[model samples]
Target: MPKAKVGRKKAVLSGNHYTSRRFDVVAVGASAGGFHAIAELLGPLPANFTGSILVVQHLDPARKSLLADLLLRHTALHVKQAEHGEIMLPGVVYIAPPDEHMLAGPGKIQLAHTHLVRFSRPSIDLLFESVAGMYGSRSVGVILSGTLKDGSAGIRAIKEAGGVTLAQDPAEAEFKSMPQAAVATGCVDYTLPLNKLGITLKNLYEAGSPKSYG
Candidate 1:
């Protein structure tokens, strides 16, 4: 539907464990000041959301993961960090372990041993690019508050592959660089505010018709 975003490159196949074979995965990327924004998006998605979700947030590798723990408290969806070889499934939340790039494939999510891109191990671009290869237009990608441009290329890849994309409105982001960079790439479909993201996602699922999420 749109051209791929520039700035970096990244790559995958997602098998069907979701609602339908067409599309059943969504990938999200965040960093800098993204905690609240991420919670806002995840809190409203029902536990029955029929697609796999993969998330990567910028975090200190040396620190214990608090993102999944924090999200568990805010949403009904089961949340956990990616294990060595966990399959991608609907109704669950998969967060990339800090300091490692997450790759989603035919039926699972894996922690990559590859070198980090843009100085961040869990690069948003990596996650998005992988999702594009596997899920294509069926994937939905959202880039939220963050510093730097980790997710820009990922968003573009998603777009090129026929996936949909949304970015938090830069004016509404705690750290606008990431969203701004995504928008600048001209591939993002929606640049919504944090408060409006939940409904937007709900709408996307609804648009998918009988293949709805939750």
Candidate 2:
């Protein structure tokens, strides 16, 4: 098969699909032991954080989402399940709905309930790939505690697109498979402990600094 003429799509912040440096979006993925870990990571981020946060957490399609309420009780950022077509806005945390794939667009969002990636709904790789596609190199992707290999491919996509990628230190992860697999892909730029991730996020947003470790 011939390669597509336009290989990777980009959401530009300027002319000719170019984007100036900015920390306007943050995408996080986790599964297995995500509930507790998410609270720990997001609770410390200030309400004034200057980046929009999108999360893809493994969950049952038939189950109710306590995640938004759970995290809301812990963080100052407004937490809610994402609404299709909503633009990314700083200080708001959008959670991916169950049994759906969440994709990022130019300051906007799109959600689908089609095929699953890696046998999971609210697929992490789907979210990461889409975000990297839209944001180019200006996004942040975090792979947290989980028990499978869901996030590695997504992390690779983000890295290739020039986005900063972070994985929780495997040793510190409650279930290390996901983060460890991501590390094995050789794309992770930071292997932070749970505590430091919050601090790092704060620094990234506040200082307008981009940390690329890999």
Candidate 3:
């Protein structure tokens, strides 16, 4: 995996110390074949990456998910299932608990048992929309390999809110429908292979400010 070069202006030091006015949080949505795609995306990120990552992957509501544990093998960042009312922190990977809708607030997490959207309880659209509303340009939204069109609208919401949005290249995706859908929205800022996605995010973090779309 390629290591990310740290930037001097807002370098993330050991532990939870870093400052930036750009993106503080990243919202990632994925489904079928996501485990591998997500692992590929996160493996290259530096250990002290300065942003929090919130993930919503379509999961079986009837069974317990070992997603956090599985993902821990691929990245140095702290990985765990998100809990309601927990304060969001930099460098942490928070996976939404099965059967719950994970929403973001200002520096915090909110989980709900509300009706499903897009036929899924842990809706990618809901998570992305919530983060877009709360963090605005201070957030980044990513759509990875999956089936169906779950993340399309959410990516649009993020883009409209002045945040960066990215999708996996459909040609490289194991399941291309989801990313293809997002790209069709005409809102994605970048569409790249999995390895490049991580590098791009690292570069964006180092930039220390949101790119002007104007």
Candidate 4:
């Protein structure tokens, strides 16, 4: 009989703690001058990153969103508008579609045309709250440049869930209101410049399975 071939299994770090600890989901919210901010924010992720990233950047519902297309030009991560029931994948970025509220569930995405929250259809609060409930301490919440108070409550929700929360430095943001509001909540773990946010996240992810936001 001919010898049968077997595929090699990818090696993963093994330990009881490593198996239990996870930092696998990152959720980001932005508005106002967010298009450019998000592009810069996502530009630095290495191709092999294992965390799935979900983003909500407020957009005009009456107009088509070119956000995914625009972002695909600058980053290594696969970018696309979130679809209902879609399973999120590592190294991919999902953006909320215009007019639809996108949410993270246990292992899938849920898209809804629900009532406007805080006067926005794709509310940052809605997305962050869902992500917090699903991923808990494994989640990362980032608030970027924007206006009004959209991401403040969301980041607070993330903190309450034991997730790591971050905000772009208000002084560095084109529109400081959003980041300022998030910082004022006292829930954020880090307030960093746009250029430093990626590297900071990389360091946290590389610190080997974060068990606590501390």
RMSD of each: 7.2, 9.5, 7.2, 11.2
Over 63-129, each residue of candidate 3 has an lDDT whose tens digit, in order, gives: 9999999999999899999999998888889999999999998788999999989998899999999
Worst lDDT 10-window in candidate 3: 9-18
- Candidate 2: the clashing residue pairs are none
| Ordering by lDDT | 3, 4, 1, 2
- In the range 46-149, model 4's lDDT, one tens digit per residue, is 77677888999999888999999999998888999999999888888999999999999876789999899999989999999999999898899999999999
Whole-model lDDT values for every prediction: 0.80, 0.79, 0.85, 0.82
lDDT of 2: 0.79
lDDT of 3: 0.85
Number of clashes found in candidate 2: 0
Candidate 1: TM-score? Answer: 0.87
Across 1-214, the per-residue lDDT of candidate 1 in tens digits comes to 3322232120001122222424578899999888898899988788777777899998998998978888999887898888877677677889898788898887778788688799889889988999999879788999999999999999999999987888888887999999999999999877777666766676566546323433
Give the clashing residue pairs of candidate 3, or none: none
Alpha carbon deviation, residue 131, candidate 4 (Å):
0.6
Score every model by TM-score. Answer: 0.87, 0.86, 0.88, 0.87
Candidate 2 residue-wise lDDT at 62: 91
